[model samples]
Target: MATVVLPRSLVALFPGAEHRVEVGEVGSVSGAIDALEARWPGLRDRLVEAGPSIREYINVFVDGEPAALTTPVPPRATVHVLPAVAGG
Candidate 1:
């Protein structure tokens, strides 16, 4: 199982959302998101867009490295989902 760390802002939108969740047997980032979606409805839509790509305002990282939907997720790895930040 991979451990997914969700941003607080995102978790706040979903009641009972946890900061960390364990998803079973996910081979890629997309699979991890699907697993999260199964647990928390509408989660995928928040993170993914119509093209099934990561939302423009969102960023996903695996094991401390930038990642995409198809990025491989090794067993027991950690995935982080965050909202992109901008400054003037």
Candidate 2:
């Protein structure tokens, strides 16, 4: 199982917004997100677009390295999902 870490922004949608979850048998970043969505409905939509691709303003990281939706997720990897922040 991979450990998925969600940002505080998205966590608000959930009851506890605990911000962390463990997903099983995920092969890629998208799969990790799928697992999260399965547990928390509507979560995936907040990160993906019509292409089922990661949204432009959203960033994903695997073990501290920037990654894309297709990025392979090795077993027990840690996936981090964060929304981009901008300020002037």
Best by lDDT: 1
User: What is the C-alpha local distance difference test score of each model?
Assistant: 0.95, 0.88
Query: Global lDDT for candidate 2?
Result: 0.88
In model 1, which regions exceed 4 Å deviation? Answer: none
| Candidate 2 per-residue lDDT over residues 31-61, each given as its tens digit | 9888888888888889999976899999999
| Model 2 spans with C-alpha error above 4 angstroms | none
Over the stretch 1-88, how does candidate 1's per-residue lDDT look in tens digits? 8999999998999998999999977999999999999999999999999877999999999999999999999999999998999989
Worst lDDT 10-window in candidate 1: 50-59
Error of 1 at 78 (Å): 0.2
Clashing pairs in 2: none
